[model samples]
Target chain A: MNGTFDPPATGKRVIPGTYVFDGDAARRGFAINEMCFSFNEDANRRAFAEDEEAYMERFHLSEEHKKAIRERDVIGMLNAGGNIYYLAKLAGILKLGVQDIGALQTGTTVDEFKAALLAHGAKLKELQTQGETA
Target chain B: MSTIAGGIFTSHVPGIGQAIAKGLKQDPYWKPFFDGWHTVHDWLKREKPDVLVCFYNDHGLNFFLDKLPTFAIGAADGYRHEDEGWGISGYKPYPGMPELSWHIIEQVVHDEFDPTMCQKMLVDHALAIPVEMAWPDEEESWPFKLVPIAINTVQYPLPSPKRCFEFGRSVGRALESWPGDEKIVVMGTGGLSHQLEGERAGHINIEYDTFCMDNLSRDPEALLQHSSLDIAELAGSQGVEILNWIAARGAMRGSVTELSRNYHIPISNTAAATMLLENHETVLA
Candidate 1:
């Protein structure tokens, strides 16, 4: 119960729609982030691609962290303390962009995620027109 | 004496850098965005400030989760373009001002805004992209001295929007009191909207972004009422980078005359924006 005071923001526990990569989350995801950070190097990216499990184990990530990596779970990794910036390196290994992570978290296809972004542009144009008229 | 000549606020989206790197500025997809900078390029050519104190957040170039500084200043003579996971090619090194960097570091610390000093740093797109956009003719090299300031907006426990404003004020004071005739420009880059990753992944709040830009030059203080969470929720997680814009506004001291402003959407997962503001005192009499 030591984590008692650390109540989640809402009844849903996780912050709705986002995972903030804060200090405590950084602490929790240290090993996982360290492994991901190493992917900055082409050699490190290649090493992980060659032998995923062995490469992950070298970082000594916890079972939960390892599982999240194994499953390619972006949100799970976030819950386990994976900062999205660092997790992006892992996402890179999987050829996934931030949109892919968004798609996975929101349960949408990549094309749909892209469509939503394009729609945002349409919405902006509409708002600009309204502003001009007003 | 050194003076805070003006402030330039813009979005330094990574894709903008890619477009420049790949020579795709003329492509229809990028033409509109690049067109926005045409005025900025002409403006920089005329202003040609001696030094530019560029403020931006690092994604994952120089600092990792191991040891991240809340506020860090680069005092090196130059910085090379970081690979940033994907390769970044053909970016010439940016010149730095070590003398002015040390003076501000000392003065701002005295002003109680303790920023970490990085003697060497590989600056990522957040700082590099805006410089490139403003000075599109890369063959001649960067004209102004750059003092790269990296704020920790990436991880949690980010400096409050209010605190960021205060920090910029301290830097402004430092620039003001410094013993030099150097013309200085403060640049705050990043954000309008568009979240990169999360359940609300392609989230773009034009209203919030518009509200921010419309009011930034007039009542930047009004924005403080909107907490970081309010910004993140209304804008996006990465949208919090607007704090740097608030800081840039603060560096201008009080009311500034806006010379130019532009806002465009979908510049690589963010709503891109630019504003050129001159200090009230420095404006034509």
Candidate 2:
């Protein structure tokens, strides 16, 4: 394998116009970014900690589902299919094994459990697919 | 039965393969690995794997730091290669298995795994450089068909390791269900730890890397059982990403039969390691 490069020409997507984020565009972009990446900030955590149900209302997920995940209830989150994928991230946080995150915990193989997961991730991807202007 | 050749799971530590080959062979911690893989190079000629499904991450070089896809599969008939500032001439335009790639993409997405399909993307040296050096092909055209599976690692908050591992299992299931009769090999490229950024650079834990290489090939489930935090503690912040290899292990039915594991450290910005495993019915060459 040497010097020649044959780049794939199809993956690049063309956009119409560019908008500066210094004005109204910036405000809108921040709002959207906040909406999607809301759970990580300290302020949001405190707010959600105070009124979990009300906070859940502001977002797309249900209060019960959000609570279950916040409490690290793995099975409840998985059964609910409500932001459970993120909870899988907690397996590492909790010192649980990687395979143990889902079916691998129950002594079943990964294949038996992944189809259901891909479907959930697929749905989530659709919800968050379109991003703002570059 | 198709014989299994070997699998590689290494950190794409920039100029690692070449740098290590240059001077690391003398370091006590590094010398054995160099010696071990010296044998693997010769074996590849004899074993000759027909296909390789490389799992690598684009270091903001291809897709950029702008938008990152959680899991992207190369489906184009050919890939656009990026020149890595380094003077190395890289691989020829890689031929993609569009029909099979798309078939798997559709099935996986249909089954609920959303894999971004790439037609035009830069094949960064973070991936191409080390991979080529590991098993250099001097005669021009590659000896085998290629299946490139890229994961987003550079950008913060990428797919969770659990998600990555499960993706590998899904990929394995996809391959198992593929009707084609060709022989195949799978590799998980990147990381054994040592953060490239922040103040925690140059960290190396021979024990942690050794444990990772051992468990990853034979009993990955056992390794994944530990929390990502545990892996991070053992490996380092970026090292926690080793679970990414679990994805490749997943395709091999969660059990690795044939193994080639290499570990080296402080190669540029990371502690690097590589593992090559074989799945059932596929021979490793």
Candidate 3:
């Protein structure tokens, strides 16, 4: 509020490759997120694993949500209004670590995502070292 | 009156909990992050504050989008940690200081900050991981009582940094007003920077994170300049958890001295940090 900052160009500032998960998205993804929220329980996770389709039906998930889950498409899930935190439960059921989900979203291998993180960290270190020496 | 010893701001990534469960503190990937806790542990051992008022965001454990409060305070006798669907093993229920919780809640609400009062609440990794990291070796139970204050960072229309800072100041005033003689330590958990949602999933902003570590204790208002949306843009969506750190920093009402600080990057797609600040000449607001 203090600074003279420009307002976002569009009604919503579109950060490339980023989703804001705002109210619109929340309303859009409520059912899916609610279903993912239920995954907090081990029994629900087990039930989902037991009969994925039947569980989806119980949540009243739309075909779009069902397809996103079926394909294990993290980005598709996001497109369908799935918050990353709730979707994390789904990822857990699928045995996907955050790095795995990152890979899936970015279309990279898990190893590649890990390597990119390391490289980014190393870059930061290099910059800091330069700052110290400079 | 209750005395605020100081504050500790830490990252509460669930992966840290996973690392601890697997005894991988010494593993190469986890060592840098875990190593940062030594100074915090030493400080805690020496200070031994009676209660820790923790400011953290719940990750779909206690409150879902069904009805989320902007801020909530726990008034329970004990808080439980259950499986978060991510296989992070549960810990024994944490002892809660309901007397302190209710006192703060009453005072804060009187001060015109209405937070949802929970008689029973389930704490998630955001609270648990920091406790585990701070006191890794304690097997039986945590030495200090906990007062969990959850702020909503998960949903849109999140509280602004200015709002959280003011709420913390109110809580600080509440703590100072309490009649008990207990020593208290305030804690804020989560974020230096990292995102996990989109193509920007592995986003890490070293410059912003360093700025935060350097400025939080001395000039927290500098942090309040960024609106929630600005923070989401600058710190990554999840990185907005820095609001926890801001709120914790605001709770100290006296001159602050940075005791020790550590920042490490790429801890499970996040830049993790831990900082300890000692509040000197603790004064009434």
Candidate 4:
């Protein structure tokens, strides 16, 4: 433990690990409790908890779906896909205004927001071509 | 039951972690905070705990908006560091206490506290700050034995304050049953009251925070009955995250002799409260 600051006997100075059940830690963590849903206000968590139906009405989402999102039950959320886009809408979040719902729900939405931007550009070009230009 | 140093409560707020890395002995507001913490430093040196169970919430670091763990424990030899996007790179590595970590995992749930056990993970800034500041002498080359506790505070529908308290009791049970000559201490950090993000970014409820300081000490069970929304409403969204401290308290039993309590506001849009807890006779030098 001398001479210009050396590591322990192992030379690696192996610190203890961070995971308790490391076997399937990341995968299990992802599948089990994957989403992070938050409100800008606790009033939101409360009002929603008090009367979810009322809360859902406040947002663009449906009642039953709000329950899954709030509960953090991902499997249920995916199964009840009517309002799969509800969370995105509530935040006024746009993964591009138009998305292929079929792909988004299945987790195969290959296109990123940039692709959506490109699609918007195509629309602009069409509008210019068909312009009743002033 | 063996002597428990009780639990430590701290804010996993990213900003504080960043501030400490710059050698927090400076900065007008922070200078005082460090001066205050230095007392704890002195105390810790005298009563060096064999193992420290740190409770912190990861914010987009370690576990992100993509994937989050409810409760994760480190069972490896050393943990890796993180950047956290704030120019504050995390510790190179943090040593973990696997035995105590595992015992808590097995026994806690049986005590009605289902902990999310972490294995092969990284230490987010939330758990790193107070550890570094409080015990800076821990050698990364051969660091002190540490066990990192990552709580699911950031993601909504988090564990309730009462649940955290019960979980603490489970932790206590686990520690009591451990076979060792090691002195153990638990610490909870984060929030007497404060919030960040969105229109409520600057919210502070000094009164509610003081109330938390009191109730969390005496009647945490009653406090847990209150919805997470209440803490979020009073303290701001981030304020409710402090329920983990109540968990820290629950583990300490009804007899916590408070060593010291300090509360501060406007610490980068946070209401910061820090405390050292143990039974009266045990805490006395």
Which of candidates 1 and 4 reaches a greater lDDT? 1
How do all the candidates rank in terms of TM-score, highest first?
3, 1, 4, 2
lDDT of 2 by residue, B1-285 (tens): 333344666666544445544665567544544554664576567667776777876643355323568788888776656433222334566666777677668767876888888876666655565456557555667666667788865433456666777788777667767777656667776677554211222334555665666677667766666655455556654565565576777667633564565544334435555555554554457
- Residue-level lDDT of model 1, residues B1-285, one tens digit each, is 777777889988777876887899999767767777766777777877889898899888899866789899999988877667664545788898898889879988998887999999988888888888887775777778889888888887788899888888888877888898988889998887867766667778877887887778778888898778778888888899998888878877845877777777776677778888777564444
Is 2 or 4 the stronger prediction by lDDT? 4
- Tens-place lDDT digits, model 2, residues A1-134: 11111111334321111111112322222322233235433465556557755765676565445654466554333333322213322342344433334343232344543443333334433533542100
Could you tell me which 10 consecutive residues in candidate 1 chain B have the lowest summed lDDT? B82-91
Global lDDT of each model?
Answer: 0.79, 0.53, 0.87, 0.55
Model 2, runs deviating above 4 Å: A1-134, B1-6, B17-33, B85-90, B226-233, B281-285
Those runs of model 4 whose alpha carbons end farther than 4 Å from true positions after fitting are A1-134, B65-67, B90-92, B139-143, B280-285
Lowest lDDT 10-residue stretch of candidate 2 chain B = B195-204
Greater DockQ among 1 and 2 belongs to 1
Model 1: per-residue lDDT, tens digit, A1-134?
00111222454334456777766677788999898888878888899999999998999999989887788777677778877777777887798766667778778887887787778777777877877511
Fnat, 2 decimals, each candidate: 0.61, 0.00, 0.71, 0.00
1 or 2, greater by TM-score: 1
Query: Which RMSD does model 1 reach against the true structure?
Result: 3.6
Model 3: lDDT to the true structure: 0.87
Quality class of the docking in candidate 1, CAPRI style: acceptable
CA displacement after TM-score superposition, residue A41 of candidate 4 (Å): 30
True interface contacts retained by model 2 = 0.00
* Candidate 3: Cα lDDT at A76: 79
Of models 1 and 4, which has the larger TM-score?
1
